[model samples]
Each structure stands twice: as structure tokens, then as C-alpha cells.
Target chain A: MATTANSTKKFRHRVMSAALAAGVALAAPALAYADGRVVVFSPPSTDNYIAAWQSGLKKKAADLGYEASFIETTRDQSEQDAAVQQELAAGADTAGYIWWPFINAAGTNSLRSLSRTGKPVIFANQYPLEGTESLWTAYAGIDDFANAKTAAEMLLKACDESSTVKCDKGLIVTFPAGFSAGADRAKSFRETVDGKLEVLQEQPAGFTSQDGYKVGSQIIPPVKDDVTWVYTQNDSLASGIVQALTEVGKTPGKDVLVIGGTCHGDTSDLTSGHVIGTEVQGAYLEGWYTMQTLHRYLKTGVVKDGKVYAEATPDAPPSDEGDISRYNFIPSPPVGNSKEAVEGFRLWGWTMDELCNY
Target chain B: MSRREIFMDVMFRTGLMILVYVGFALFIPSYYSVRGVAALLDGAVVIGLTGLGIGVTMLAAEFDLSVGSLAALIGVVTLNFINGAEVGMVTAIVLGVVIAGVFGAAQGLVIAITGINSLVFTIGSLIGLRGLALFMSGENTVNIPVQRLEETDFLSASVLGIFSIPSLVMIGAFVLVAAFLRYTVWGKEVLAIGGGRTEARAAGVSIKRAMVVAFAISGALAGLAGAISCVKLGSATPLGFDTLLLSAVTACLIGGIALEGGRGTVTGIFVGLLTLRFLVGGVSGLGAPFWMQNLAVGSLLIVVIVAQLSVRQLKSRHDAPALPVH
Candidate 1:
């Protein structure tokens, strides 16, 4: 009788273990299906503007009842590919992906890898290369040509009003060479102001206020008397230019007209009248709309093609296939020296304070 | 080691520095002005400090490639302590320096125990420490309020109407390091070890202890440099000092420091730092295009290294013993 009872107890234990294992196995698909996370492949997390974009993306994702996560990549293209591969291997049920392609041409491998995941991939910040659109669902960012044209026009207008400085000669302090946006902006600015202005010097001041100050200090002193206007690709560089000019006893607005091409941070220069004008690059709105477009595609089973969105708003509903191109351009409005202009600025429900303050 | 050799070395380096200054003054008129000199010296402070640290390690026959990363790490830590943790400025600076020294000692201990190549070990530390900095700072630029920087802004202060506090600090560091190497028994032992580890061991020197101390001093100086830069910039950025390691190494090489170890002068290093800063400043002032500026620096460095190598070969031939007449 004791042997029989022991056998029965052993049998009961095996039965319970088998049942538990089978239950977990049955629920595995449900757990996998429930994950609605959107992964953002971004540049190094240290960049202030990129951080702001991610923050906006996360905020928008949360509001839409979806979870958002980020995978940091070094500027190296292979590193970006590796990061995407590692994420995919984890087997999470990802809703979609946002790719910020660290280097535009070098990022083709990353795009191809994400395409294998069979999820919609939205190219953010950096524009994708040609012939790689099959892998990318849509491109959402500022139009580099239009943005540069706007900045050039602003500088021309400033030059026209100033009586003391000649409108014919100017200097451009731009981002480092080989950067797509920098190259585009410089080309467009030169073309737009071709006959109107003669570019005395085009220097790469980098994207930091310190570099800008150093470069400006070195270049401005010799031409302090002749140069009419100084155009910087960003506000940090513009602020640096102002500091360099001020150190030499030259008033920025009075001695030389300064324009910050992109207003991303520290609008004090704009507000204080150091810079004559700037434009809203809408970094936060870019991140927000990338996710929004991805969410729409996932919900509606339709891809919006060739439609250019303005001010982070989708102009048309999702289409199956139409005359829409692959590119979607976000409208970036210009901001002037007036306090009212700055205060009244809004891009996709975000005020300047929210977008500019990282 | 001969007096004539020593004199030639000093004169050669000093003469080169003077030539560079005169050249810049001729090409870029503004480079000779008081403000231009001030700006050049100001720019040299951080690189000079880093070069000094590299000089120390090179003197001890060890290579610390992580000096730049260590400086960046300490900068981040010091700023975070003062701004984020609300630690007092003095306490934060002291703590940052101490931590850096300890980190150096730990690296020394690893090299001492494992007997690994100092270059490889420190290269690993270089990569690891930069990642650590990024992690600690959340990969963000930490901005300190301008008011928070005022008390510790001695690095940027003008001292005697001619020199800034940072220039003085660099000078003071050179003096102290020179004195220590000349007067201290431990310093003598470090030189001996660099001359030959086997010979040093036979001569009753504590190789491990001396190396650890050298590394500690190097780390402390790097930390101080980072602190100065933090105060000067009023912000600590993750990649702010990325150019530091290359600049320091270039300064050392240009200063005539023997890469194989054990031979260099603080004075030579100082002049080298000044020469490099002037060259960069002068290039920019000359309105050279951005690409041209980079090409010029690269070409100059290559020429210097090749010239130094040619000199070494010639010196070796001169020192070679005469063959016995048949």
C-alpha cells in the first residue's frame, strides 16, 4: 500500500509540471502580439537637438497609447546596422521603426536591414538616399533647399534696409563640410544670393558656439570694416559671431547684419536683437510627426506617398497609391527680431519655449 | 646627457618656437598684439596640461593614451557634482582630482601585475573611460551657470595685465614638475626605470611603486586641466576635449620628447605647446580655407616627425665608435 501511494504522488507532480509548461506555451503568442513598441534608431544620445526630437517622439507615442524606445548608434554606419540587428533578434513585436540614418549614404545598409524586419520604417532628421525608398515607408524632415532659400531671403532683406553696410559682400559660417544639410544650405544660399551678394569667405565653423567664436574671431577682425552681413547656419554659431564682433567693439546689428539660419536653442540672441532673423527648424515636430505617420500607416493599412506635410500636420489622408512622392516636407517659418513674432510662433502645438529648450 | 647635447636640445626647441612666433607675426599682423598672445596662451592651457600629463607617463616608460578621456571624465564628474549634486565647488574639484588619481593608480596596478604593454592597456582604458563619461553624463552637455563658475574662474582671470591665470598655472606646473624630476629620489628612480627596467631592478628600485606614482601624478594633472577647461567654458561637453589627446601627443613629439621613453624637458614641452597654438591661430587668422587649415596642420606634423627621425639617425651615426685603424 505504501509503494502504491508513493507512485500516485509522483504521478501528480509530473502532471502539474506538464500543465504549467503547456499553459505558458499557449500564452506566448498573445504576449508577443500585445507588444506595440516603436523603436527609434537615433544618433548618439548626447546631441541636444536629437534629444529634443526623441523627447517629442516619446511624448507623442505615449499620448497615442503606444510605447516608444530608443537604440543609440554611433555615427558609424556599421554600428547602426549592428544596433538594428540586435534589436530585431530580441524578437519583440515592434509596431514600426524610425531611422535617423547617421550618414545619409552610408545608412543604406541600415535601411536594408530594417526592411527585413517587415515593419514600416520612417526616415527622420536626415534624409534617405535615392533608390532606397523601397525600404523606407516615408521621409519626414525639413526641406533643406526651401530652408536655405528662406534664410538667404531674410539676409537680403536685412541688407536692403541697412544704409551703412554694403549688400554686395557677405560671409557664411556653415557646418562642417560633407554634411548633406550644410552642403545644401550653402549651395542654395549662394545660388539665391548669387548676383545680389558676393560671398567673401565660406568657412566651416562647426556646430558649437565655441568653434563659432574662435572661427569668427579669427576671420572677422581683418574684414571688420568691409563685410556687410554674416550668415551662420545655426544660432549657436550666430551667438558666437556676435560675441566675437562685440569683443572687437562692433555692434552686430549696426556694424554687420547677422542671421542665424536655424533657431534650435537659446533664442536669447534673437530676442536681444543680436541676430536679425532666424527660422524654426521644427526638430520636435519632426520626431512627433514621424511617429504619427507610422501610427497612421499601422492603423489604416495605407501608405501616404509623395504628400508634403506642413507644420507637422498631414495634409491628406493615407492613400493606397497616388501621385504623391516619397518625400514629406515640414514647413519651417521664419522668426524675426520682434518679441511678438517669437512669442506668437508655434509648430505643431509646440511653442518656441518647448521646442528650443532641451 | 652631455652639457653640449643638452644645450643644443634647449636651443633648438626654443629657437623653433621663436621662429614660429616671428613667422605668424609677419604673416598675420594681429598675431603679435597683446590680445592675440593672450588668446593663444588661453587656447594652449588645456592642451598644455594634457601634454604635461602625457610627458610624465612617457618619462616613466609608460604610455597613458587615456589622458584625454580621463580629463573629459573628470570634467563631467566635476560639473555634475557642482551642478546636479549641489556639492560645493572646492569639494567637487578635490573629489574629482582624487578620483582621477585613484583611477590612474588602478591602471598602473593592472600593468604592474599583468605586465601588459602600457600602450595596449591604456588604449583599452581610453575607450572604456570615454564610454563611462558618456554614461555618467547621460551623453549630454552639462552647462554650469555663469555664476557658479565665477569663484573657480581663476583659470581665465588676467593676472598681471600681461598673463592670464591659466598661463601662470601652466608655468607653475612646469616649474613644479621640473623641480620634482631634478630633486626627488623617486623621480630619479623613474628615469632609471625608463632607461631600462632590468637595470632599475638590479639597482634596487621599486619599479611598481614608482610607476604607480608617475601614473597618479599624470592623472592628477589631467584632472586639474579638465577642471580648468570646465570653468573656462562654463560648460562640460561629452566631446569637448576629443581633440586633446592628439594635440598633447603632437606637442610632446614636437617638443623633442623621446617616444621610447625617459628623455624630455618641461620647458621644451611648454614651447612646443605655444608653437602649436600659434600655428593654429595664425592659420585661422590668415583666412585659410577650413580644409587648408587641416592640411597644413597634418603636413606640419608629418614634417616635424620626419625631421626628428632624420636627426636621430644622424646623431646615432655621429655617436657610433670609430673603427680601429688597420
Candidate 2:
């Protein structure tokens, strides 16, 4: 009987050891990477550009082994504030947050709330306003001032290209007030071309083709003969201007060169020479950079106190052992009005269709 | 009302529009000619049609807060029907309008039966309909294909060098609405309800039917405006009508349409739209800042409202029976 009890004890000990090993094997991957969630706070995907940005972020999040959970508001600051509170309540497992405010300048309180969480907060698409640099870990998007300046420089070349018209007098059909980028771009362009080109009028329209059509149709008739160039801040707006000019019995390129500052919807105008050119400020590329910057912050936990424009292709992970700069802006390069402009144009390993068309 | 009275009323409204228009023309460059007036009207088409639709609802002592959403929804639905469903453009547009009419009628019936406040109920509809528009559009601008662009090119083409098809449609709609209110029994019922809701019910008005008719007309007109604009603009965003409702409401107020329902005319609404159009376009054309436009429009609106109220008080005082004692 003593010998039988000893054998049973040995067998039980072995079973326990095997069970312990199996449990350790099962939990190894989980222990190695927690796969926490990255919360994305943003406005409703009300347009393709925003949708593309969301998609780009989603892809980057997945590749980094983190799931992206989005909290959408209806472009309302109050709604965004409420969303932030709810998100903060259950945010312990969050890797970080990528926030896009409804109004960039109006929602500083919510931005402060994100900063208080002690997790990296990355701003997407829109750049944070001045004096709020401490509120965000990093910002990744287009620099509107640089973009408009680039277009203004390119526009100088088109001044002598108009065959029958002097491209000296121009009109700027810009974005409505309260939108910071429109103001930034318009102000930058005006400052750049102060004496070189005469800005006859600056009307605040919307960021859609319909707004362009309505405003262009209304504003172009009286000054049709006087204006030899038109700078619509959006490509969609440029398309509408093309139609508007044609409707009013004026040939778009021959009468007025429509310079699309930002390449967006309807690139056909570029191929057809209706729009002289537009700078590539790819929303997708911007989104990809945003996620990369956020991930770099999560990995390194260091944010340098300065700005860097990402002029390279397919933006790299932060340099110097993954230290993300404060503002990571994508390049905005001007392309001419030809098939060669969009057919094979690449901004940081992103094709025109993959970047601008988004 | 007698023909002479109708003629006098028409003449008075026309004379008022002319005087205000000429006054604006004097200060606004390029606005003294026929082309300028046409362009102003053309730009005002969206607000004008929306104002007319809202004006109809106001005439019944009720108002619609959902017309803007309805416009966007119908535009999206129509574009999808044409492009996605591959239907004829005209057929798609008409179907969209009919659907809008049915939707409005349903809302009207619900409101009438439940005795719900029009403002509160229509605000709910506004949110729901805008959601629907966003869903149908996939959060993108529903662009009509290039092949179809030519089909609607004529809409933007100048008609007689003074008007586009859109402006003509707007004018025709105003005329039709004016005739309906002046001649049709349902229109009079609407006016009567606006004038005195209790009195109209006591006089055996089919309140439900009248509400349905009013909402249906408003919905149809609003849909037509959206269809025309979508075709003209080559696309429609779900948020295309973002500022349209406010502009239309401003038009109604400027046109002296009483919010409590009963006392406004289609002519007054048109003139109101014209005033707003000329003010905004004129200022912008002359390179005045947006704040200046706001100030000018605000001052004009204040002056007009004050003048109308003073006239109304005087007329009421004059029409009062001479009482020997209080």
C-alpha cells in the first residue's frame, strides 16, 4: 500500500506540471502585446475625403496590431465635448487617441480634456491653432499656408500663358468664414501675390461643387471680361467654375485660367486644361502620416518641440529613435494641367488616385 | 375680393419691389441693368423656392422646419435613381418629387391627428430626413455622371440673355403658388386657417385635408428646386442645404410673412428674396467685407420690419370703429 501511494503522487505531480506549462504557452502572445484600442474622435464622414482619411487611419491601426474605435460627432463642439467625457470614463486600455475637432479654434476645452488623459493625443487632418501646442502630442496634415503659397508661385508662370487674355486680374472664390484652412490659404495666397497679381474679389463660398457653381455663376458674369484668372481653393470648386464660365458664354481656359489650389474631385479638368494646375494635398497621405505619428509617440513616448514637413515618400517612422516632431506636415507640390500630372504622380509612395482622389 | 382690389394689390406690391430694386441699383455697380437683375434672381433661386414652400406652410398658420432636409434628401434620391437605378432623368426627378409629396403628406397627417406643434414635429423630421440623405449619399457628393452632364446643361444656359431656366422655373412657381392661393378653395382654406384657425374649423373646413394639401405642395415645390439645382450643380452633397433653411426663413421674415401664420403674399416673398439677393451679391461684387454685408442687410431688415409694423398699426387704428367711450 505504501508503494502504490508513492506512484500515485508522482503521477499527479507530472499532471500538474503539464497543465502549468500549457497555461503559460496559451497566454504568451497576450502577455507580449495587449492590443489595446486606439480611440479616434472625429466628425461624421460627411464626404469622401474624410472617409478616405478614416480608412487610412484604420489600415495603419490594424498594421500596428491595435484596433481603432471611432467616436463621431455632427460637427458640433458640444457633442464632441460630451463624447470626450464618455470616452475618458473607460479609457484605461486605450493606446492613444486621434482627435479631429469639429471647429479647430472653438473646441480648446475638449482638447485640454484629451491632454489630461496622459495618453498620446494625435490631431488628424486639421492643424491645431496657435497656443494650443501643449494640448496635443502631435499634428499630421497639410499645411494650408504652404499649399496656397505653392499655388501662388505656380500661378505666376501661368500669367504669361493665357493667349488672348492678361492673367493679371484674378478673383478668389474661397471658403466661407469659420473654417480656418480657407482663411489660412486665402490669406497666404493674397500675401504671396500681393503686387504680382491683382485680386479683384474674394468671395466666401463653400467647399463643394454646388457652392462653386452657384457663386461662380453669380460672380463671374459681371467680371467675365475683366478676370483673366480664377483661383478656386478647391478642385471641386474649379470644376464648377469651368461649368459656370461655359454657361455664361465664356471659354474657361481661353477666357480665364481656373487654378485649382487643392487637387480634389474631378481631375478631368486638369487633363482637359480647364484648370491650369493644383497642388497635391492628399487627405489619404495626411491620414497615413497621422497614424504613423501617433504610433511613433506610443512607442517612444517622446515628442520634440518643433515642426517638420514630410517631403519624403510614404512618410517614415519618426527619426532619432522614434521621436515624433510636433507638426508632421505632408508635402504640397504643384502639378501642371496635363495627363502626366495625375497619371503617375506620387506623393510619398501614394498615387494620385490613392491620395488626391480620396 | 374684386378684380379692382386684386389689381390694386398687385400694383402696390410691384411698385414696392421696383422702388426697392432701383434704390439698390443706384449704389450697386453692374446692378443697374437687366443682366444684373437676372443674375441676382438666379443666385436667389434656392432661397426663393424654399421661401415659397415655407411661405405656403406659414399661410396655414403652420410652418415647416424640414424643407431644407427634404431638399437634400430628394436631391440625393433623385441622383441615385438616375445614376444607380439607371432610370430616365425626367422620370427620376418626377418620382423623387412625388415621393417627397407623399412623405410630407404623411407628416402632415401625423401632426394634424396628434395635434403636435409644427415647429417641434418638423424639427424631428428634419433630423431624420437629413440622416436619410446622408445614408443614401454614402457621406459623399452624389455626382451625376459626365455623360448625363449634357442632359442638364441647358438649365444653366442663358434664356434670352436675361434669365436661365432655373430663374424662369422660380418665377413660374411663384405665379402658380400665387394663383393657387388666390383662386383655389384649398388655398383659401389655408388662408382662412392662417387668418383664424378656430373660425375656419367652425366653418366646416377639412382641416386634415387642408394640412395634407399644404404640406404636399410645399414638399413638391421644394423637391423641384433641389432637382433643378442638383442638375445645374452636377452633384449634391448631403449637407448642400445647410444654410438654405435659414436663408429661406430670412426671406419670409423680410417679405413680411407673419410667423403666426396668416398675412403674407407670394409677391412679397419674391421681393424679399430680391432684396436679400441684391444686398449680398452687390456687396460682395463691390468687394465689401462680409461684415459689411451683414450690417447692411441687418439695417435694411430692421427698417423694413419697422416700417411694415408701423403701417399695420396705423391701418388697424384707422379701421377701428369710433367708440364714444372706452
Query: Interface Cα RMSD per model, in Å?
Result: 23.2, 22.8
What DockQ results do all the predictions give, each relative to the true complex?
0.01, 0.01
| TM-score of the second chain for every model | 0.93, 0.91
Off by over 4 Å in 1: A1-358, B88-90, B146-153
Lowest summed lDDT across 10 adjacent residues in model 1 chain A is found at: A314-323
Worst 10 residues of 2 chain B by lDDT: B282-291
Q: Write the per-residue lDDT of candidate 2 for residues A183-218, one digit (tens) a residue.
A: 788889999989889998888677788889999989
lDDT of 1 by residue, A267-298 (tens): 88888888999988767776776677677667
Fnat values, candidates in order: 0.00, 0.00
What TM-score do all the candidates reach, one by one?
A: 0.51, 0.51
TM-score of predicted structure 2: 0.51
Per-candidate local distance difference test: 0.74, 0.75
Q: Can you write out model 1's per-residue Cα lDDT over B105-196, one digit (the tens) per residue?
A: 88887788889999999999889988888678665556565345445556545677547876788778888887887789987777778878
- The prediction achieving the highest lDDT against the true structure is 2
